[model samples]
Target: MIKGIYVHIPFCHQICSYCDFNKFYFHNQPVDAYLDRLDQEMEHWSRKTDLSEVHTVFLGGGTPTSLSLRQLSKLFDSLEQHFPIHQITEFTSEANPDELTYDKMELMAARGVNRFSIGVQTFDARLLKVLGRTHTEQHVERVIQHANDLKFPSISMDLMYGLPNQTMDHWKDALHRAFQMPITHISAYSLIVEPKTIFYNLMSKGKLPLPAQDLERDMYDYLLTSTKKHDFEQYEISNFAKNGLYSKHNSIYWKNEEYLGLGAGAHGYVDGIRYSNHGPLKKYMSALEEGNLPIIHQNFVTEKEAMEEELFLGLRMNKGVSFSDFKRKYGNDLREIYQSQLSKQIQLGNLEERDGRLQLTYQGRFIGNDVFSEFLL
Candidate 1:
């Protein structure tokens, strides 16, 4: 079954310093017009693919909650026109706490959106100012409570570490705040200053005081210990979820399953063809208005590339990869394909195989990207 669909809404209230996502500062002209094209794109794509099998739909951002209820309803209405969408199991939308309102939450719930992911980067107002986040800690708390009151099936909060002027105590407080809600998932990510972000500019000017290497690692280790203590499973790198509450749409990406993506700057793969949408709203809308598919590029995954992706992504889970499933899917022995890397890692006590399961050792998980990089083909 086609188990995942991702729709990117590329508008945000304002740009954040640490962000480099495909987004524009919110504007009246572009936001309304972009939704129109997104509606058309969905209708056209439904005719292009047998989309009946889609089991989950995730509306991600920029910030999907930026949309007015009317805009969101129009978007959802367009989809219902083309597909039997009620079968979609996990419908999620990303929200920033400032954009979340009781009416918005209630409206989404009525429209079958069962999951919400709040972008609560930090509760520290000073840190939020540095991060260019518009919301406050109290906003996050209220939004979580509001979603719980609305009976959302899943609620998630996103946190970040390795910021300037952060301490272990601050991080611990943030984790504590996360637990105060009935949130089923929390994602904590390290702050990596990408070249395009405002942080990178400050860093280049030597105006930003970054945490030292030891402190960064300490942040990660602390989160690991704290989450496990709280009974939140560290399923993927930077993600903690309560049992069975792991993001179903995100799993499709990590598991390398087929999915369709619509809207500006979205990426998807199905039937071995991977493609991305045009990033600019003007470009996307023009193409859709002309009744043209807005895909800017595509690559057909070779069997070798597919197998390599499967291995790299599967290892992200704590359950690891089943040797039987690997062989069953690829028609090749896992031991043979990864023999050299596996042997070297096992000898170094970084990787192991036992009882038909292949996974990284505790030591290996810390350097997982290193292990994953070995399979890059």
Candidate 2:
């Protein structure tokens, strides 16, 4: 059952240096036409699949709030018309601090949007500029304040560490300011300069001055300690939340559950297959216009691949992977399948078996990518 729906709005007012997501500048783009095509795509999907009441509806970006008030209204109107929302417990939209205005916040609240995932990046003005983020620290403060005032059910912010010239004190300041807000969730990530991003180009030319691996690890340590001290549970490696405030939409992905990925550049898993839509705007819109699903690539997940994914994705959570659940799902014991890998990881102090679940140890969280790689068949 596809219980979650992710709608991507790939339009941004300004591009971030570290971002590599498929998006175009909001100025002078065919914004209304894109939304119309999105509506048509959703309608076509509904007719094909028995999709009605989803548990979560997430409108992520480039920046969903970049749309005009009228355009936002039209987008939601299409959503409500095609997709039922009364049963959606968590309806989220990602917004940038500068563009997420008071009026837009009000519109979201009125439209049953319960969660706002704002991109704060960092509180340091210099770092913000280096990251090519246009929002100021003041803008973040004001946007978060407005969201709090409106009493949005969940207010989550994205923060990044391990930037150029960023120190422990710099990280501490960002974390300190984050906890000061009346927010429920915080997702902190180490900056990775992916290929094709501005940061990547600068790094290639020796112009980027990112922190060392050890310093980045130290920053992650501080993040864990500080968030825990503030009574937030580290539900996943990078996600911390107050009691019962876990992001339901994100959890759907971590649990490897089925979801519908709508819009260009979106990836989704349904039944036993994983699929991605076309990333380019022209390819996406043209497919939809020609009464096609716009799916550029898809693969049926083999049982072996599914089990491998189960370990990697499930281990991202603090609870790790359940031994019994794995056995039940695959009709085979996990230990029997990867005994050598499990024994090696445990011997190396990177993993442990506790409470009938195989999970990453505290040490393993720091080198999570390496730990997850061991599970690959």
Candidate 3:
């Protein structure tokens, strides 16, 4: 069953230095045409799947808040037409702190958007400039205040560490400022210099002075400790939430369940086939114009591949993978299939079987990639 719906808004007011997502600048583009095509795509999917079963709908970026009020309304109108917007338990829209105005927030709230995931990479002005972010600390404060005033059920912030010239003290300061906000959740990630990004070019030229590996580790350690102190539970490896306010949409992905991915450059996994849509706006719209799905590439997941994914993706959660759930899903004993790897990790003290759940230990999270790789049969 498709438990979630993820709509991609591939337009950003300003492109960040380290971002490699499929997005374009928001100026002089066919914004209305794109929204129209997006609506067409949703209409097409609605014919094939029962969208009413979808419990969560996530509006991810570029920046969903980059749209004008009218554009947002048009998009919401389409969403309501195809899906039960009010029935969705968690409706989240990713926002840029500078772009999310008071009126926009009101429109989103009226449209049943219960969560705002603001992109506030860092509180430091120098770091914001380095990251190509236009929002200031004050902008973030005002946005949070507005969301609170409107009484949004859940407000979340995305933060990044290990940026160019970032120090331990810088990371600590960002965390402190983040805890001060009236947010229910925080998703913090370390910077990775992906190809085709400004950071990648600078890294190639030795111009990006990133923090050392040890310092990055220390930053992550401090993050785990500090968020716990602030009464936020680490539900996922990088996601912390207060009062059990976990991101239900993201949890669908972690649990390896299927979802419908709409709009240009979106990806979806449905009926054991994982697929991504055409990224170019024209190509995406052209496919829909021809009454076809905009999928560009797809692969049918084999049973072996599914089991591998089950382990790696499920291990990312704090609860880890349930042995019984694995057996029920795959109809094989989890202990027999990856017995050697599980034993190796458990003996190494990186993993443990606690109450039939194979989970990562404190030591394992630091070397998570290395540990997860061992399960690839």
Candidate 4:
């Protein structure tokens, strides 16, 4: 069943150096037209599938907060028309601190948006500029204060480590400032300069100076220890939550569950097929205008591929993958499928079995990508 819906808002007031997501500058674009097409797309899908099972709705970006109040209302109206908005258990919208004003937040709250995922990469002003972020420390604090005042059910912040010229003190300061806020969740990630991003170009020219591997590992270590001290539970490798305020939307991806991905450049898995929509605005809108679904690529997921994905994605969470669940889903004993790979990782002290579930060891998480790759058939 498709239990989650991801709506992408690919507009940003300012582009960050490290971000490679599909986004256009908010100014002078056909914003209203795009929203209309999005509505049409939703209408098309609503007729084909039962969206009542979608308990989680996530509005991610470029920056969802970049939309004007009227535009947001229009988007929300379309959502309510197609999906059971009132029945959604968790509704999250990603916002940039500076762009998300008090009024915008209020509009979201009135429309049933219960969670805010604010981009607060670092607290240091210098690093903020380096990351091409327009927000200051004041902007982040104000947004958090506004969310608190609105009594939003959950407030999450995104932080980055392993930044250019970023020292241990810089990371510590960012974490210190983060903990000072009354936020419920923190997602700290190490930077990976993907191709086509500004950071990638700079790195190609040797202009980017990233932290050493060991230092980056140490930074992650500090993050785990500090978040634990602050009474946060590490639900996933990079996600920490307080008061059980886990991000239900993201949990769907980690569990390899089916979800509806709407908007240009969005990807979805439904009815055993993985698919992606057209990335370009023109291609996406033109398809919808012609009464098409805008799907550009798709593949039927084989049972072998599904089982491989089950291991690599499920192992990211703290609870890991259950042996019984695997058997129920695939009708194959977990030990029999990948016995040699499992044995090798267990012998290397990188994986362990507890309570009939397979999970990554402490050492495995640091080299998680390496461990996950071994499970690939």
Candidate 5:
């Protein structure tokens, strides 16, 4: 049973240095063609699954907001034909302020989009231009105000730290500015140089310097403390949400529930099988038009491997994994499976076993991946 759905729109206004997410610099010519294929895929999938059990739906992307109001309206029309639209609890779309205006927000609202996740990487105008962003800080403020005026159920902002040429103070300033807005959620990302990204090439050319290791660590420290100071709770490693506002769609993925992914480069998991659509836009459309699923690869998740995934994905949350859920799923106690590994981590203070549940300690949050890597057979 699929509990969630992810829609990927692989087009962005400008490429960022550290971003490796599947996206291409958007040109207007391909918009209609791409959405046409997306419509076909959604129609096919709607017939493929029952929509009764679906709980949450997310529209993610290179920047979904890049689509024109007309295009977005057509997309919502296609979505309604396939899924239980009113049954969806959370309907989120990733937007950029430059492309998102009052008209676009109102169109999405008219189509029942109740949640928005706008990218506001920083408030510094110079740094924003350096990052190749088209919008100014003022644009973000206006977009947020408009979304709030619509009475959207939730509004989230995305922020990044540890950027090239970013100082500790600059990082704090970004967080400070975002908190000043009426946001119910915040997603923080550390700058990572990814291959083929302009940011990666700049680092390779020595034209930009990454934050020092110690400074990066301190920046993360600042994130944890400042978010806490703002009365936000860190539900996942890089996600903070106000009370009862955690991202339900994302929580489904981390919880390892079966979900469907649509559009180019989107991934889906169902009945222990994991698969992804073709990454290339043209290739994806061609394959689907030929009546194929456009799937590039598929794998079966073994019982043992699914368990390991549970460990890491669950631990990414501050609450960690649940023993009751573990036993119910595997007919095996987690402690019995990873007895030594768990013991070693607990001794190192990276993990804690308390209150009939397991969770990561404070120090564990920083080095969590390291601890998890050891258990990834």
Candidate 6:
């Protein structure tokens, strides 16, 4: 049974320069139609499987808060009707600082949305402009303050480092300012310029000047140290939480559990197959209108692939991969399948077996991509 649901809202008020997610400008789009199709897609899922009360539901975007107050209400109502909201321990929605108003916050609270993940990329004005973000530092403060006033149980914000013209001092100042907020979670990520983004185009033209590898590493180290000092525990590589407020929805992905993915450009894993829906808006809506799912691709995982996924995905968490759990699930010892790779990583001082789990050491965290790559068989 799927324990989680991820709904993709592909509409954004403004596009950020570095973002390459599946999104479109909110203006002049068929917003209501898209929401209707999303609802239909959920209904489609109910037809295929016994829709159980999901543990968590996350509405990620193109800025889900970009919708008008009425639209947001309709969207939430539709979701509650399709997915059992009463059983959800966590219901998170991504919001932009500028667009997240008090009315929207009240609506969210009334509808049982307990968590808010606001996009506050950087507190610096210059860096914000460079990233194509329109919100100022004041907007972030205001939105977070309002969310706190509403008594939302878990508040999280996203920050980015390793950007063009970003420095250690800028990063430090941002971190200092973030700790002042009433947020319970922080997700700090290093910038990666992907294809089809403004940053990628600028780099091709010799216009972008991102920080060096060593400086980026310093920023990451500072992030870990600072969050730890602030009484926040690092749960995942990019995620840190105060108290025990780990993002349950995201944990599902890292734990390699099944989830239902709804809306355009969403991907899902159910049974043993991983599937993705049509990315284009028109195609996604038209498919639902014709009473068919917009699934464009589906891959049935072989045992070998499943085991490989178990390593890379599980290793993403600080708790690491469980040896006994792996053996119990696969009916084979983990060390026996990749003895050479495990020994090599251990010998290199990058991996350690502790508390009946195999996890990355401090050195391995720095070169995590390389360590994860070695697990591919």
Error of 6 at 302 (Å): 1.3
lDDT of each: 0.86, 0.92, 0.93, 0.95, 0.87, 0.92
Candidate 5 per-residue C-alpha lDDT over 1-377 given as tens digits, one digit per residue, 9 for 90 to 100: 88988999888877765677789888754877888888888888888777688988898888899888888988898888888888988899999987898999998988878889998888887778777887888899999999999998899998988877789989988998888889999999888777888887787888877789889899999999999999899999999999769999999988888898999999999778999999888899998789878789999999999999998889898888999989999999999889999999999999998776788899998888898886787
Model 1 lDDT tens row, 14-114: 89999988888887657778877888888887877877778898989898998898988887887678666789899999999989899989988888899
TM-score of 5: 0.97
Candidate 4: where are CA atoms >4 Å away? none
lDDT over C-alpha atoms for residue 35 of model 6: 88
Candidate number of the best lDDT:
4
Summarize candidate 6's per-residue lDDT along 200-303 as a digit string, tens digits: 99999999999999999999999999999999899999999999999999999999888998889999999989999998999999999999999999999888
User: How do the residues 1-377 of candidate 2 rate in per-residue lDDT, one tens digit apiece?
Assistant: 78899999999999999999989988888889899999998998777776654789999978899999999999999989888788899999999999999999999999999999999989888999998889998899899899989999899999999999999899999999999998999999999889999999999999999889999999999999999999989989999999769999999998888899999899989878899999999999999999898899999999999999999999999999999999989998999999999999999999999999988899999998998998898
lDDT accuracy of residue 373 in candidate 3: 96
Give the per-residue lDDT of model 3 (tens digit) for 225-252. 9999999999889999999999999999
What is the lDDT for 240 in model 4?
99
Candidate 3 runs further than 4 Å off? none
Which ranges of candidate 5 are over 4 A from the true structure?
A: none
Listed per model in order, the count of residue pairs whose N, CA or C atoms clash below 3 Å is 0, 0, 0, 0, 1, 0
Deviation from native of the Cα of residue 50 in model 2, angstroms: 2.6
Model 5 clashing residue pairs (backbone)? 17-199
1 or 6, greater by lDDT: 6
lDDT (Cα, 0-100) at 369 in candidate 3: 87
Cα displacement (angstroms), candidate 2, residue 347, comes to 1.1
Candidate 3, residue 314: Cα displacement in angstroms equals 0.7
